[model samples]
Target chain A: MLFDVQGTATDFFTTVTSDAVRIDLGRNPGLNWDDFVNRWRVAYFAAVAATPTPAGTWTSVHSIYRRTLDALLDEAGVEYPDTDREELTLAWQRLIPWPDTVQGLRRLGVRYTLATLSNADVSAVVNLSKRGGLQWDAIFTAEMVGAFKPDPATYSTAARYLGLPHSEIMMVASHKYDIRAAAALGFQTAFVARPLEFGPAAEADTEYDDAFDLNASDFLDLADQLDA
Target chain B: MLFDVQGTATDFFTTVTSDAVRIDLGRNPGLNWDDFVNRWRVAYFAAVAATPTPAGTWTSVHSIYRRTLDALLDEAGVEYPDTDREELTLAWQRLIPWPDTVQGLRRLGVRYTLATLSNADVSAVVNLSKRGGLQWDAIFTAEMVGAFKPDPATYSTAARYLGLPHSEIMMVASHKYDIRAAAALGFQTAFVARPLEFGPAAEADTEYDDAFDLNASDFLDLADQLDA
Candidate 1:
């Protein structure tokens, strides 16, 4: 099972928001940290989507996130210092896993191999998984493949390295676009809903979609559905 | 900490020999499984040593091992069936971990980020590590980098993906050549002597060389030496 890590397993909003608030505690107070984090997420999505796919021209997700953070801060007319900006950007490397994330992975891991196929840089995935106590049998990241998810090269390269046909590999993700891309490449798809992914106030698409091969409320439900 | 997984962490000798014995129990009974495994290891070393390092021309260790297995079996005049030959070759994917491998890694992991930097194919390393219950924060395999160990690309590429300065990353291995290659690239070196890596009768080097940054008898001793 290949996991889409950012929002599906780890709660990036909480981590980025918490770090923003902590960094801006006395220096840059009254800024809506939550909104800032949400925008940061959206900006990150836009940055990756806009990135070109050819191998040598690829920029790492870490560089893109840092650049996005700087642009947003500059646009908001905030004077968050360089160190704090870096720390906040690095917050992506320590995102906390959801309550059921670890247990559910442990359950599913018994019957299947688990790995990350994320747009995040290799270091970010490694550090985040280490910090979150997320045990994966292997890890595949955009840094190694030189392309972000939704780019066919990302999934195709990982499939090559895994030495497994696309049919045997299931893409388990919370986002429809991610699973859809994997499904396009003949990969089995499992959609796990993270209703509060964007935040408590934001409405995330939580309804089960029959387009995916399987759908579940969360990882635990996914494990149960797969009988793992 | 970057580990050389095959002999340093996992007992490839015992695993391969046991599989060979089981596969050749009724037929080819007189063949010395111990000698066969040692010769296989030697041949694997020679095969990887001969491989060129340019990216696209590189071959996976899995292919090398499988080819080497076929050659050795054919030379021995043993009529090992294709299925048994394939199964025996797959034994490399299920190598058993050394006694202190798991416990020592667990201890060292608290203070350091542990990862595998192996000559093995990604799938083989992943499968063996999973079966052995050996936990690593990240995995860096030769197959991903398009070169085997002792080639500068292998070490440099892994260090790049790790996002760490070569000075800060320590390469830990049982073989001096492996650590020496890492040391040449400015990585700190740790030598863990595996006395039985070849087999009980073999004169495996268990000597401590001051040339390495540190040397220990086993993973536990290495952990203790590093105060992990």
Candidate 2:
């Protein structure tokens, strides 16, 4: 099973917003960190989708995070030192896994080879995996594929490296677009709902749909459904 | 640390020779399974070195292993069914780790990120890691790099994906050639002696030399030397 690391395995919404709240505690008591974090994520997704592919040249997720953070901070009228800005940008690297994530992954790993095919940079994913105590068999990323999620090259690159037919490799993600892209390329899709992925104010769409091969409430539920 | 999986971590010689002995038990009592396994290793090395890279097409180590096994069986006058040949070639996928491999990796993983930079295919390394109870942070291979060990592209691809300067990522291997190649590309080199890498009948070159930055008897010793 190939996992999408950002929200499905690790709880990025809580981690990032918590970091933002902690960093901006005294300076901006009125700031809604949850909204700020969600907006930042929307910017990230847009930036990655719009990032240009110039053949040999590469743009790292670290740089993208930095760019998005600078723009977001300016738009929000927030002031922070360069070091704090760098730390805030690096919050993605220190994301914490959900309560059921580690045990569920361990159980699933026993019966299946579990890996990450994340949109994050390889280094970011590596650091996140280590910080979250994730035991991934392999880490594949947009940095390796030279493209972001939803790109045909991304899924194909992962499938090629896995040496498995697209039909045999299952894509598990909290995001519908990621799974849809994988499904279009012949991969099995599992929609794992992270209802608080946009924080408490926003509820993610968790209703079961015919589009995905499986719908799971969480990692543990996914493991149970897969009989792992 | 980047590890060479086939020998430094796993006891492939013992695993392959035992499989050969079990499979060819009644077929040839005079056959030296140990020697046969050693020769097979040599053939594998040669084939990987000689595999062609024609632009975008890939040559997986699994295919290389199959090719080498067929040639070796023909040369050794050992006739086996195609299914048996396939099983024997896949012995590489189920190699057992050395006694200290798991414990030492756990110790090292506490301090430094540990990954594989092997010549094996990604899926093969994933299976071998799972079978041998190895907990690697990431798996990088020749198949991912589109070339074999000792090739500049192989080492560079790993360093690039790791988002680390070659000097920051230590390359650990039992073979001097593997370490030397990595060292030439500025990767820190650790020579871990696997005295039985070539089987008990053949003595491996275990002498510590100035060429490598660190030399240890085993993974545990390496962990101690690194203060992990």
Candidate 3:
């Protein structure tokens, strides 16, 4: 079993609200929640898209997040806050799980060796698992492979850690990109729809148009599909 | 939540019966179950006591088990056989939880973050957790630290990985040595007594006189003490 973090198990907006208030009041005098959310979105996607080049050049997710956030601040006619990037990163740690996440994961834990194969670091995943009351057999991270999702090596390494072949393991997520990556590598894929992942009235194009092995509307639905 | 692997979870002697028969058939050409049990007792303790020192450079639990079996053969005046160690180890994988273990662990899991900090490798522990229907928040192993139990680093690292301070985490084990070590490192200790860990008639020392934070007759007793 697998899980996603932000926008899946956790509410990205709630986490940003508290973090924005904390950061804005402390060092940044006029930063607003909307500005923080937009900057965070830019940072999040930039991190997902950056990659290493063939010339041995490396572009880290953290670096991408930092650069993208800086550019967003500039575009918004605002100066980049003098807050520590590490402190900003720690905001991700305080994310609240979705309403169904805890109970759904508890149910799944009864049958499968549930794990999180997300882009989150091992430490972040461990912290989230503890706070969310999620029991995971193993916590695999992009940090372990030094690469992000859509990389076969990450999925293969996760399977190796689970002591199972790719065919025996399943990757469960709300993101088609992640599920598609695992599917191409021979893993069973399950999708959980997150209609409000980007917030109300935001068009997410929440459809698994790509060929995925299984799709569900929520974690409970995923559990039903797997158990059935 | 912790578990005692031997009689508390699985019948150790019964599981290894085929392995014992194969060894006897290849070596002495004829040996009884009594002889096999005797040899196994020596091998098991010897395996436990033969931890590597700095200069000695201890081996992994897998390698130690292999060497211990070899020594057992030599002591029993038998020859080494080509019996499958992996298959024999898989018998360990199929361990049955004591009638109380499942209920006890389920109760404990409701309150605390349950995990297995075992001498068993990650794969072995994961398999046992699956087979026993155990839902652990994390499954840690000596393999993570490349060191066995009684090492402070192992307990400390396990606690650290849980994102908890040593005092917040607890070490639960049947072995006094494991609890003592963990207690010295500031982790709360709970000892679950297993008088027949060695054998029923074996006259092994059963009293846990160490200063463990809590000592109980069984996992259920432990659950009671922990207010689970």
Candidate 4:
């Protein structure tokens, strides 16, 4: 549930397959990974930025991410292909859990409830849990709430579902923006540092402040910090 | 925080302490543990039975239990010393984990999300998790939804908050009624056969059929099933 893109799971960008995707772009002379990434990023932001606020409240991360993905495909002039959006979405379901994730979560499991409050769909999370060998009493996602993280409702709803007070539940994430919103709502927060989340340190913003209740280098360190 | 009332935790039942006020129930000229427990049981059920339902919904365990206690005191012509209620409540908060609960959860934690969706309040669940040394990704209770088990809302709310579909979430319980309701709402269901949940050989009417996806004799067995 507390996952980052790229480096957290498989080193996709460095993998032969991902490198091939990049190579294909490079060979197109007019297109490159950087340009393609930039274009997708722009479309992602534009789509999220354009979403109408509901009853004066901001749009949720769930909505933003979903719309962002839609916009990126549209702007790229690419169709979803035979896999369709649902199967493509299932990619998240089969993502490899980080090498340390299973053991770390196992250790933490000795002392706390471990769940992923991700942007993935419920079925995706279920399949991911099954495939990754990650067990959770619950797997929460933005899709369930029809909104995304950084939204108070998402965190609050999670706590409410767990039958816990906001203060009693802790939101552990690799993103500051996610933790900041959780903290504002009175939930305890833990930061799991995923330095190469976006690719490499040079391309990633790996710096974070000591604003969380606890910060760790990885899931194992997090387990140590929680005394699991 | 899977726990048994009599054997697991030291703090659950009311202890006969000199500091605690005693209601001399004329029926049991002498205060015995059995007598006290019988009276408490009656108070507990009566309280639950008296609660006013919402529309078609039933009264929650908390409301029923608290009210029942209050009414029992009134019927016995006894006034509980202020300390008595606090001590009794504290006892509830102090339930000990079953011996297998901690280790079993740790094992299951390696493969699944483990949580307590109980009738206990959030505080009680949190405290139990801490006292019993059990780690749950989330702890759910009726207080979160303002409704008790067997109500569709409780399960639905839990699924929504965890960002999971009802089907992806599984409910593990000793009570058949709870499992039935959860299954009815599309949650994967498992029943832990607490044959002695009520007392020695006093079966709890735990009949298993197609409703449950898995049924096991204990937490360890549940772990094995899920792991397999």
Q: What TM-score would each prediction reach against the true structure? A: 0.97, 0.96, 0.72, 0.62
lDDT of 2 by residue, B106-208 (tens): 9999999999989888888998898888999999888777778888888888888878999899999999999999999999999999999998889898989
lDDT of each: 0.89, 0.89, 0.67, 0.58
Error of 3 at A193 (Å): 3.2
Evaluate candidate 2 and give its CAPRI docking class based on DockQ.
high
DockQ winner between 3 and 4, please give it. Answer: 3
Kindly list the per-residue Cα lDDT of model 1 for residues B1-228, writing each as its tens digit.
Answer: 999999999999999998888888868867888998999999999989898777456587877888999999889898877888889989999999999999999999999999999999888888898888988888899888887888888898888888899999999999999999999999999999899999998889889999999999988998899999
lDDT of 3 at A216: 79
Ranking by DockQ: 2, 1, 3, 4
Residues A1-228, model 3: lDDT tens digits = 767676778877767666766655655556566546755775777557655533223344445556666666576566534565456556666667888888788788777777787776555676667776766767666655556777787888677656688898888888788888888888988888888776664556468654778777778887777673
Q: Say which candidate scores most in TM-score.
A: 1
**Candidate 1, residues A89-186: lDDT per residue as tens digits?**
99999999998999999999998989999999888989999889899988899878877888887888878877799999999898999999999999
Q: What docking grade applies to model 1?
A: medium
TM-score of chain A of each: 0.97, 0.97, 0.83, 0.73
Off by over 4 Å in 3: A14-35, A41-96, A99-111, A121-127, A130-135, A142-154, A180-185, A223-227, B1-86
In candidate 3, chain A reaches a TM of 0.83
lDDT by residue (tens digit), candidate 3, B1-228: 434344444445554665556534555556655446646656755676666645224355555556666666566665544565445445545555555777888888778877777776566667766776766666676655556677777787677555578888778777677778888888888777666554455554457654777877777887898899
The digit string of per-residue lDDT tens for model 4 on B175-223 reads 6777778888888887776554443423355566666888777778877
Best model per lDDT? 1
Better of 3 and 4 by lDDT: 3
